[model samples]
Target: MSTPLKTLFDLTGRTALVTGGSRGLGLTMAEALGEFGAKVILTARKQDELDAAVAHLAGLGIEAIAIAADMGKPDEPARVVEAIQAAGQSVDILVNNAGTSWGSKTEEMPLDGWNKLLAVNLTGPFLLAQAVGRAFMLPNCWGRIINIASVEGLLGHHPRMIGTIAYNASKGGLINFTRALAAEWGAQGICVNAIAPGYFPSKLTGYVLDKHGEELRGDTPRGQLGCDDDLKGATLLLASNAGAHITGQTVVVDGGASII
Candidate 1:
């Protein structure tokens, strides 16, 4: 492809912050943004893991920095925002990829587990968005908020899938949150959207992958589960200049799994 065509997906002069970015899907998304020319800031609870992730990205010739923060904490968002500002970075692209999942029967699930899932999956994203938007994005009149949701948000879990009530509910809330925020913020130049992934091989889906790898691959019409690279194209479409007009929607990247 020509350089000009590639420019549509370029993120030059952009700064991105991704939560839960030390490993798994967050790091995957961070790699995509950084590789596309965005200066990326990655956050997770462990400083050492973040350091390793940053080093990996740096080795790839991408500018990446790692910060330590637990997004699940009520006050941590503010601290994270402040840390980014203190480093002289204002997030232009915010990927709310920090999330947690727990599974149990409705009656068997602990209240603590339910609350923890919501705290990370739903509240953390909103708080971080609020911090970044109010502190930076609004003044600049340009921003992108990409929520990493799941197909479970749209449809109930399969009987074979086991308990994930809290996860499902939180993701559903996140989708609605994206729409509501987009409706109010579209004219302000902030685009809120989501990507509802299906059967990605991440920490959240490791159990299923370990147990039903063959079954998952065979059941999906595409005959495959998602890989880290699978997220890059959809992510760039949302974060780069190409997707300016797109907002308030969830782009499902399930490789035909959901439809099948």
Candidate 2:
């Protein structure tokens, strides 16, 4: 007999680690996994934020915990992996969502800003994935890696409207990283994928939303910005057994914005 559809999406024994999961898109995805029966671990730079997120998840009756670690720091990935190991669990799902952005004109962009964005947005995810995969996934021979890329990664943004060249480049690199890593690890039962989200109301895009909310809405065929729940479904699909055969793919959750 074939497996039931609901059973395929169930993640009862899974553990998920979500970087930058204290707020915004990361938090949204974390909640989805937790709600569907995965134990979730949230990582970010702030202990207070992490505590609050854990409390929120607890209120929702989801098993959750927090680890305060800045993904940009080189030593932090090992620390995060250690924390999980200490808890007597390994990550079955990894979400690379911790990132930072800088807005500046290309010619006038500061070298420091460029480097900082790349470190946090691109390099951080790479290191963390390496640590987790080595310590857990590779050993167990089963894992799911969901990279949080952006629509900006898929297309160039207008310099005058949004000066985030480094951010765009970093996310673009992450998208390809997802594809490359999937190819390398698929034979070992590790599925790697990416989610490229469009505009959503978060601290990361507060300034842009304040200035161009209407303009962006007009640009999107949906005539609206994404809500908190917009990313939940796509994330669940990729994180569960439902996506067993899906790997090396980027599911764009932009309400048809990228289509145009």
Candidate 3:
């Protein structure tokens, strides 16, 4: 008999770790997973924001825990994982959503800025995945790894847009990292995938959107940028049995922004 649709989407008994879960896309994805019955562990650099996020999740009746850690720090990922483990929870799902960006004309970009952005956007995800898989997923032989990428990864930034070559390069690397890791670990029952979002007014991209909202909207076939709910469906699928057979893929949630 075929499994019921609801059964495929259920995430009960699962624990999800969402880096940068203090706000924006990360929090949105956390909400999706939690709404489906997963216990969520939200990690970010600021404790106050995390506490507020936890409270918000609690108000929605979703079980959540918050940990503050900077992904740019080399040792932070392991700390976050160990903290969760100490609480008797294993991360069944990991959303590598913590990232940073720097905007400068390519030649004018500072080396330090590029390095910092890459550390968080690319290296941080890899470290967190390694720690989580080694500690929890590999032992249990089941896990979901979702990397938050960007449409800019698949396509170069528009000439009119502020230059963010480091951000673009890091996200591109993440997309390929998802594919390679999925191929390597699929046999172990770990699913690796990515979601490349379009313009969304969040802490990270609010300034860009504010500066070019009309142009971006006009460019998209949907005539709008992404919204709070835009990333939820894709987040839930990749984090649940609903997408068990899916791996090594980048799902673009850009309202058709990259099609052109």
User: What residue pairs are clashing in model 2?
Assistant: none
Tens-digit per-residue lDDT, 1-260, candidate 1 = 53466888899999999998999888888889998899999989999999999999999888988889998998999998898889888899999998889878888999999999999999999999999999999999999999999998998887786689999999999999999999999998999999999888877788878987888788789898998899888888999878988999999988887886
Ranking by lDDT: 3, 2, 1
Residue pairs with clashing backbones, model 1 = none
For 145-254, candidate 3 gives per-residue lDDT tens digits of: 99999998899888998899999999999999999999999999999999999899887887898899999999999999899999999999999999999999999999
lDDT of 2: 0.93
User: Which window of 10 residues has the lowest lDDT sum in candidate 2?
Assistant: 156-165
lDDT values, one for every candidate: 0.91, 0.93, 0.95
Please give the lDDT score at residue 205 for candidate 1.
85
Candidate that would win on TM-score:
3
After superposition, which runs of candidate 3 have C-alpha atoms over 4 Å from their true positions? none
TM-score of 1: 0.96
| Candidate closer to the true structure by lDDT (higher is better), 1 or 3 | 3
Query: Using Cα atoms with residue i matched to residue i, what is each candidate's TM-score against the true structure?
Result: 0.96, 0.98, 0.99
